[model samples]
Target: MVTEELYAKDSYIKNFSAKVTKIVPSGVILDRTAFHPRGGGLESDTGALILGGNTYRVTEVKFEGNEIVHVLEKLDGLREGDEVEGRIDWERRYRMMRLHTASHIIASIAFSKYNALITGGNITPEYAKDDFNVENKDLLPKIVEEANEIAKRGIKVKVYFLPREEAMKIPGVVKLAEKMPPELETWRIVEIEGIDIQADGGPHVSNTEEIGSIEVIKVENRGKGKKRLYYTVKP
Candidate 1:
């Protein structure tokens, strides 16, 4: 078994084709793929796989142990050794990338300004969210304005891999997770220059400027010291 290559990192793999090696209830397995599996609260890629002049709609992209699964609409004539052309819904993907990156910007800014720690997050094509440590309810309006300003500045967003030992040496890398992320020696790190950075695995926009209007839609106190923020970045 081999770990599937998550194409979200590249953010520019427009198309691909692969041979089917296995089939299951949710989706079929391909030798390779450009579709992203569901993880990190980001939705999976949805598109079409064209084979033998027939197109199978890919409804969900997921992982089964080590194999990448492409769930599809029931269609006739799918079998082993078949070659299929995969196409990603770029418009939707682009939105998700922007939203995902914006989440980082907000998280970075909030963490630094308030010395808060993130407890959880959820990202979707239309919007994204984060839970932060909050001291009082009076700060909602102020935090929202600051986050929107960060997005408007369009700071640089870059990705890089750090050696595990070297990564631990970095000032902001969190070593507190119950299980550190896998392949962290080659950690896919996201950096909003002069702002925020973290070990992340998901699609992101190349520049912070691409994140158009960022709106802090809502904020609520989930419990003691925790605040949840619901946000959407303008496309």
Candidate 2:
């Protein structure tokens, strides 16, 4: 059975209760989960599961088809049908939320100003790096400045689902040419009001202002027409 992914709808949900639906050597599957699995260039969330008065550290969270598997360090007493409390490491997850949202803002600016497309990207608690299809490295400074300016505007981030067909028609909704979102009937769309909008499945903060300020750490010339920008959100 597929797990209900709460994080897709609510990024701020740090704790949840779920019943074990299946168990394997690797990890356990829950009927519902707030745990964000490793996907979309973002790291999986780390946390602990409390069951029967014992705690199990979630070493990894991954997707097995539509199911979310919470890999544990040890599953000594876990069993199917057992109810458990899942609590995410908020500090780490919050950092990821900020970084992920910042990525969209930065990518949006690059696209608007230079018509660059996001080639690839990754998000971490400490920083985020996005590669864009741009030739000149000199544009990095201006893009960074504009991204920060947008973030400081306190734009409200909204998440909603739309039919795949309708979502595809929205301009600037898909940034990566090769990395399209899964062909689900309904696609989750994250929109930074008046700033950016994209078909995304990853968790993100609810406001651009929550990202504070982004500092460009490094700019790299990956190859012809490829520029990588590494940035961190200042607290």
TM-score for each predicted model, relative to the true structure = 0.89, 0.98
Most lDDT-accurate candidate: 2
Which regions of candidate 2 are displaced past 4 Å? Answer: none
For each candidate, the alpha-carbon lDDT, in order, equals: 0.77, 0.91
* Candidate 2 residue-wise lDDT, 113-166, digit = tens: 788998988898898888989999879878889888888889999999999999
Error of 2 at 196 (Å): 0.8
Residue pair clashes in candidate 1:
154-209
Q: lDDT (0-100) at residue 25 of candidate 1? A: 77
Residue-level lDDT of model 1, residues 1-235, one tens digit each, is: 4535648468767688888888777778888788888887789989999986788999988877767888899746898789889899988888888888777766666666766666777788888877777767556557667766877786888888777787767765652224366764477777888877777778888887888878878888899987788888775
Worst 10 residues of 2 by lDDT: 174-183
